[model samples]
Target: MIKFGLLWHKISLYASLLWHKISFCGIKFGLKLNISLLWKIWDYCNQATFNEVVYHQRTISSFLKVVFKEVDSNFAKLGTTNNSWFDYLILRRIGVETRAAPPPSMIEVHWWPPVGPWMKVNTDGSALGAPGSIAAGRVYRDHRGWVRGCFHFKRGLGFAFETELLAVIYVITIAHHKDWRHLWLEADLAYVVRLLNSHSLDIPWRFLASWKWTLRLLQDLRLQVSHIYREGNNVADLMVNRDCSEGWWPYALDEIKHAVALDMSTYSIIRIKY
Candidate 1:
């Protein structure tokens, strides 16, 4: 009896979701929705079990294809201006808003150089597998775009996040050794950026030591850690991809000068189309 009740509840929920989609698309596109068609769709959604959303998606899509073909009002063009009936249901299933695409300017990403005398250090970490060989890389560049320091260190047996934290700790150590007080650190990992910014003590036990060391280093240095798009962080990404032998020390900027120059010239004006 309990299983039967649960199945009925899910079927009702699916029917409700399907109805909402049809109504929303009809109102938004100024289309005359066929009530008979809407009922058929709801019935189909109701018959599909809770875990069969993907499997039944094809049937729903095929029904929409026939309905769209009969309407013959360029409802396909309405897709660009507003969400289609099928898309509306899919978006609701995935918990996304049904709205028109934002302007291109809204999605544009820019890579700005560090301001004033502050040094910008971009770091990234790569791993072949979760528990496989890991590597952390960082490229330190000044306001004038000169590479002050960079390195790719081999860290054996760790996950991606572990290597990212390792890179952060290692770079902070370099800054401390150089006694650089003003610095800006950038990484492609948003979670790591948030951890650094919040100075959160609640972290995995394995990274507790590195986390404490990072906090200690931050005490003496004026540092700003931020998250940047991977596109803006090609230099550090290159370092992450490189192979490093045992006891590999940081390389000077001159070694990766060619790649750095290319990234600098192309960093500005990242255009993203919706």
Candidate 2:
């Protein structure tokens, strides 16, 4: 009988050192192998090494899988017409073609009046402490840059998203009251826009009744919904939570007056996307 005692790592040596992949076989014996050989075969993160792990999925099998995957990726990137036997095997198993990254984009945005006979409504919400006192507002304007009417409401404690949804419902209710069927609605909150376009079940239970009523009123109107960045929607931001819920057009707030003038003149603001 061969002297197994002569072998440095008896457990790994018993595998007869699979000549084609000795390194791969060595990692399979990590649990009982010598510490020096185990160190070379497997890697451990800070959390896994000193035992600070919140992720409990780390194991010898997973480490070997990760190592082989990274090797497969590097060989795939080479994209050489004539690949070696190992490279060919890896590419065939991965079964994917390399692709180039898409280029970045830069866009310029500005508030534009609704075309033809349509009216424009911009709405926004604010909460000083997010979960603290909440308020919301909406402004109405026409193609001629004339303010028909506007309302700002300060309500009981609520989250900002709730305030945003409430603001949309408020605008819808008022639009029905005023019999404004042809309207273009805009908001700074993308969530509000998405909510309007999705099923009512997507909202919180507290807002379900209001959401249903809003959607019902919307069915009777020619409402066009869209999203605007806060920069372009600053007019609504400035008017929110005034002394009273009722506001009229006469250049009362100087900042709002300037913003309306800028939008009317078709001045643009550059929006950068990284």
Candidate 3:
């Protein structure tokens, strides 16, 4: 009886979620994105949740401020708007009437595919030791989760940023070579994504020439870059841990094959946090 009651409760909750989804239209991220936000609203009901509301509002504002400020700083550094900086800002005016956003919540996440004509690349880079042996890896997949390609490279005596930045540059190079003009680049490093989106000149001087070339190539292609937490980037992370000195895999490696299959089946990996 208890289990039956719990099932019914979930059904009712989902029904409400569906209704709200149909009614709300602020963010176009779709049902999956809003699910956790709505779930967070009622996860722990009481004064504590209200307190969290205040905390999260401040956190979101600060995060947005920092990201925008960084971009603005980059714009100043470049002193030009013609460069590709991924200008993205959807400003919504807050009227006297408003909706309350809920605090954060744990959610299931998975490898999401790009729409048709757009290929995706998930990448990661790590150093054995800071300023030590560093390597990077990337996996290209289509909307059907078809393994388009897998590549990685090793470098001796370099900082982690070298691998991370190189990972981005290499993926762009691949896209151009393959004529995949529509590209979606995903990386585990938020900072790396920010650098690309900001078009910052703060990169290492050694890569400045290569970075400029990539930026120019970006103009000729439709490209997007995003950040995913390390967990969701399992395929690329696994690629980095292997000896890729042999170079491009004819197919997905055995270890990461299961993950690629799960993505093809639209499987979600659950994440729980305190």
Candidate 1 lDDT over residue span 98-171, tens digit each? 44434555344555668877888988997889688998878888887777777778867988988888888888
Give per-residue CA lDDT, model 3, range 188-269, as digits (tens).
7877888888888788899999999989888978988888877788999888888646387756778789888877776787
> What stretches of model 1 exceed 4 Å from their correct place?
1-110, 244-255, 266-274
lDDT of each: 0.68, 0.65, 0.68
lDDT of 3 at 274: 32
Ranking by lDDT: 3, 1, 2
Off by over 4 Å in 3: 1-105
- Return the TM-score for each candidate structure: 0.60, 0.59, 0.60
What is candidate 3's CA lDDT for residue 127? Answer: 89
* Clash number for each model: 0, 0, 0
2 versus 3: better TM-score goes to = 3
The residue-by-residue lDDT of candidate 2 on 196-261, one tens digit each, is: 767355888988988888888888998888999887887788788565545444333554677788
Which pairs of residues collide in candidate 1? none
RMSD of each: 11.3, 12.6, 18.1
Model 2 spans > 4 angstroms off: 1-105, 241-255
Q: On a 0 to 1 TM-score scale, where does candidate 1 land against the true structure?
A: 0.60
The model with the greatest TM-score is 1
